[model samples]
Target: MASVVWYVCLAGLLVAVSGQIVDDCVLVGGEKKSDVDVAILAKLAPLKNKRFEAKVEEGSDTYVYTFVVCGRVITNNTSTNEGLLQTKVNSKDSSVIGRINETHVISGSDWILLSYRGGDKYDSHCGSEPRTAMIMISCTKNTLADGFMVIKEERSKSTECFYLFEMDSSVACPPEESHLSAGSILLIVFAVLVALYLIGGFVYQRFVVGAKGMEQFPNITFWQEFGNLVADGCDFVCRSRPRSADTAYRGVGDDQLAEEPEERDDHLLPM
Candidate 1:
């Protein structure tokens, strides 16, 4: 049982190492290009689980190539040859053409190149070097009708005995930079300031001043006074204007004066 567990752990470790795309596909710009890599990976995540196959003819040989991006290709293996990118079927019936890149060497710039070394050897047409597979990633804003296509199944005069695969996908596009507008920045700053003011005030009142209940509010009195002042100002501006004094009160009539009563009082005093 312990040995079985150990074997299982080893298998899992091998799977992880073989499936690691980041280690196999290094970014062109290193650390600074990490964001671009992340963005591209996120967009390509849909393709992570999907594998593509295409049939192409090179010279007299016709081959069906199978591959995936940032992932491994799993299929029925008729031969002992093993690789993520391989020829599933070929007219020559050689099991596999050759493992173009078996070591999974990292290469490419804006475009990503995944190459691995170590596999079966190619015929004299190419060389005695071990076969390898190379998958190149290219980005497109357009839709992905097909995932990957065979670029060259066999070695060219200038190139070595390796299989080349290329893919065009929207996932390779750079992410659009999003920035906050001036108004948004100002609004956020204002909200943060208000929150800080209230929180600071509450903490100070609750602990420093030993306040309880509603009194724990910071500058509670000042805020209340400010609210009242604001209400008063609004009322003063919106309420109806007062009537003029001339329209509010009427003048007294001269005929109603009390001068005769003073004269009668003086005469009574003299008598």
Candidate 2:
């Protein structure tokens, strides 16, 4: 029991002596990290104490919030000064994710917003070892078609490099990328084309195939033959009486033609 007390006292002394800035803090959870940095959260003297800039309204009354950690909430007060924060690098929690309002393409560093988890749970658990770190694998907010989303970027050490991922209320990526591709559109077009081809073939078969196997096309000879056939059929049907004279004459001529034969030239006999 005496040893436990000493250990607790020693921990308190170490925390007090370290008296560091936001960069020195350890990450607990909720935010991702990366070796490849997306932006410089601070160009100079980063992760240190500062008065809450009006541009970075971190949900505090006035310029009261302490400091900005890369992927975690602002620790309200960890320094000797009222609005000052201590630096820490081993973060356990992440910054808050806020909405991006612009429609234009946004890229490179210099992002728009900052956010993180706050409260007792974060303060107690953050900045510890074995907590490990995560990368910002993606922040797909800029890619969304709806033109609205909230996201944040953070850094973590793994594989000797940083990675990037996302955390947010909404809109980093659409539910599916299949809608963004041409596959669905191509399939619809192909189906419509096939239907048209089948319909055209059916229409051609029905309209072009007459009582004859293949209907004769509308050329000069075809029209003339068609006219003759129609006239002959009409005359035959309207005949007032049987004309045996013409019929008998035509039959006798046809029989004579059939009976007539050409004289044979016997080349073998002549030789």
Candidate 3:
């Protein structure tokens, strides 16, 4: 039983760790420029007949970029309330340059208002223009399509990076979302369940089993009571016996208590 419980606990731990590793890998790979644009963008809502633009500038130690994304969330028979999203990233090293509000409701009539400004540190050895980078956007509505969005400089441009202006009409708004990741919540719940199970098992073994075993045999309290009863009976027997130690050790003889003969009567006549 103990071994089984241990194995279960170990399995749960492994599962939890694996889930954590996967989540971390996703985030890290997403941050890397090598990540697939479609994979990253799959998380956002789709856009239709919309265009995106990137403007870049070099500061003292960093490269700054501003993104303006405009798109409408598409809804069909199966979905509703598509949201428009726009986000910006710095090119030196792909980090969130900035994000607009997470959920922008896009009705058939509303155009997405998306703009963000963010920057990354510049590498001194790299050329004046930052390397090519990608942005991914996703939406919950299935009607929304996912694709790659890229930022790069024109071939001949030295001081200016690439500009982007493309319209997508097939995308829809992302579904209503929550802050907590599903995997994280599952891990927490599993941990709590395992903890409770262990605690309950421990308590049952300690109190219930011991109590049942004691019920079938003499307890310390019963033995103590029996001891006191025997002690009282022995005291009564001792009190009833003769008090003298000599009498107790050796029995009294009646012949030793008889009087001895007198010798003084014959001498009184001569005086």
Candidate 4:
């Protein structure tokens, strides 16, 4: 039983360490399309009742954007749950645009992740360039949602480039208050003390009382003194009134007093 308890404690410690690691590094996002990425900074914007700006950058071969969104989440008063801050690159023309929603639903303390990939379908034409888009969404709290669209221009392999788009959201969920009551804590402490007292009492009764009883009889141990007392009483009674061969033999030397009684009677009568 003790080994089992130790193992359980070790497992809990390992889980806590692992959770800390993941929380520090991995960006929270939805698991399916249409599902919001909770890790993005933009997700938390609404929770603060403020609008945050999105930063966009265009590279020679790819474009990148950073944004913040706000949502409800469980956190300390000073901190907020930064939602998904994603970076995506269009493999074709390098054209990129990023957008993220500011609002989200409060579903416990879990997070979400949303992902997307380019598809072959053309959404529309931008200027003279034909645009196609694809999207994928997933949630950490539950099932993934429907895919959202992202529009990108088509281009030849020689001119093909990548476009990167990033969306960040923040959500804050209030921390839960402790459920333990003062009375409950007191009761637990009282129970533990009572158990210890009972154990101590039992040990004292078995060892201390028994040792004192043995000390009362100096000549013999307690058990040996009890046995000798019983034996001496039996011998005195059997010798005083013999009923069997063993008793008769024990009384043989004492029978000389019986003969003296007969001799005294003869002397007192006419003889």
Candidate 5:
């Protein structure tokens, strides 16, 4: 049993150390990074070609947000707007809000957040820093309506700007894992241990001890004795008749008692 458990543990350790690639969204080769559930990302894969649009009015300017998942942002409006994330369109003029620098799926406290880093920098008035985008994808059970909304643009103290967006979809939900119960695991281990014991015992008894037939079994003598004891106990308990009192105990005036006095007659006379 101990040896079987050791082998099972060793196999599990090897699998964990191999670190086979399970998903692109999962974080690897990092110390403090947590693994992002790839199921959510996989659910969003179908939306890669589908672009989500939202319009938000702030002060005097209106902003239009268009984005996709696991791919570049393509609005199909013009060739110049191929990889742009957000576009600031006002009454008279239109400008780029953010350009795609890089995109990654990162793990949040309870959900997944997609980051779109724009490479294009803004003017000196906006701190001359590249605008970034964050899309918060939340899991939803409502399959009928998928919510898509733009939260707002946040301007930080460092003059850097961020476009915040939110999405509620069923794809962001974590996948359910199929796991074996404790009883199932224990039964498997016990079966493996029994197989190993039987095989090892057969090999040793057949070759090393030169045993034949049923004697090749391990602890055959002990098993045979145990079987006999069990059979005897069953017979005693299930007997139909009981011994008579005459045979159960010797009578005080039996013929053997009379013969015993005659056999000790010499000793009685001498003593």
Candidate 6:
């Protein structure tokens, strides 16, 4: 399985490198036609909502800059500033392509490549630098990698590209919110536990408790025990009630005689 994944990723990276736009691409109206790549970018227009991260070095220090798609602001931690920010984002589409020494802009059927200067730092002035830097993003159907990005020289060779990890199928990218939040997940788990308890109790009463193996406890039925409890409670509540002299009591329960007083004796009996 691991080998299969590795090969798929390799193929995807190769595809990304091969699709580098030697020209620029743009959108005029709604139609799209690229010079060299697939429709990957067009399909993932939603990428604008996602954030991507990569490490860049400035002098002797390395900082992680997270790029916000379709937005100009780059930050070390995805904010406008810890102390600095990136300028406006420059966006182009598959409809137009440009090729020049200062910048190489190309649009292909599936990919777009831009080689410009000064997207190198998270500082505000970094956007104004006049040095060449290129970024190429291309999508793939490979199970191992949803896409790959080129951050080095324009039309970067296969060795210079980085394949991205697989994407979430339900979401276009990793969501800012967890797929499953801790609180809601815990509530679902608790509900499942309660359901299981009720089911187990029912099964025990209907089958396990009354199976042939339970003959040893035949006198312990639920209703019988419950009736005995109710009778005991009633006796306790009525313990102080007056009793007639004619009634015999034993073990705190009245025991009526089978024989009744004779007709003559009944007439002389006092209430």
Error of 5 at 222 (Å): 42
- Which residue runs of candidate 6 sit more than 4 Å off their true CA positions? 1-41, 57-60, 74-105, 114-133, 142-271
Ranked by lDDT, the better of candidates 2 and 6 is 6
TM-score, every prediction: 0.46, 0.18, 0.18, 0.23, 0.45, 0.25
**Candidate closest to the true structure, highest lDDT:** 5
Estimate, for each residue in 1-271, the C-alpha lDDT of model 5 and write its tens digit. 6534433454354435433322222232333332232333443554544567787787988777666554446545663322335567845434444433344465442456776555457666458777666788887755512566888767654675776778876655544556999999999999999999999999999999999999999989998999999999988899866655347565676666554444445756745
Candidate 5 residue 80 C-alpha distance from true site, Å? 6.7
> Which stretches in model 3 have alpha-carbon errors above 4 Å?
1-115, 124-142, 151-271
Per-residue C-alpha lDDT of model 1 across residues 109-204, encoded as one tens digit per residue: 345555645646655556566666677777666755256777775666543767777787664454455698999999999999999999998889
Error of 2 at 111 (Å): 2.2
Model 2: how far residue 146 lies from native, Å: 32
Ten residues in sequence with the least summed lDDT for candidate 4: 140-149
* Cα lDDT tens digits for candidate 4, 23-129: 22223244232212222322332323232233334465443332222221223584333232234455433222222222223222334333222222233433333
* Global fold similarity of model 2 (TM-score): 0.18
Candidate 4 TM-score over all chains jointly: 0.23
lDDT per residue (tens digit) for residues 45-108 in model 2: 2323322221122354222122223322334463211121222234443322211110011123
Top candidate by TM-score: 1
Ranking by lDDT: 5, 1, 6, 3, 4, 2
lDDT of 4 at 72: 15
The alpha-carbon root-mean-square deviation between model 2 and the true structure, to one decimal in Å, is: 23.7
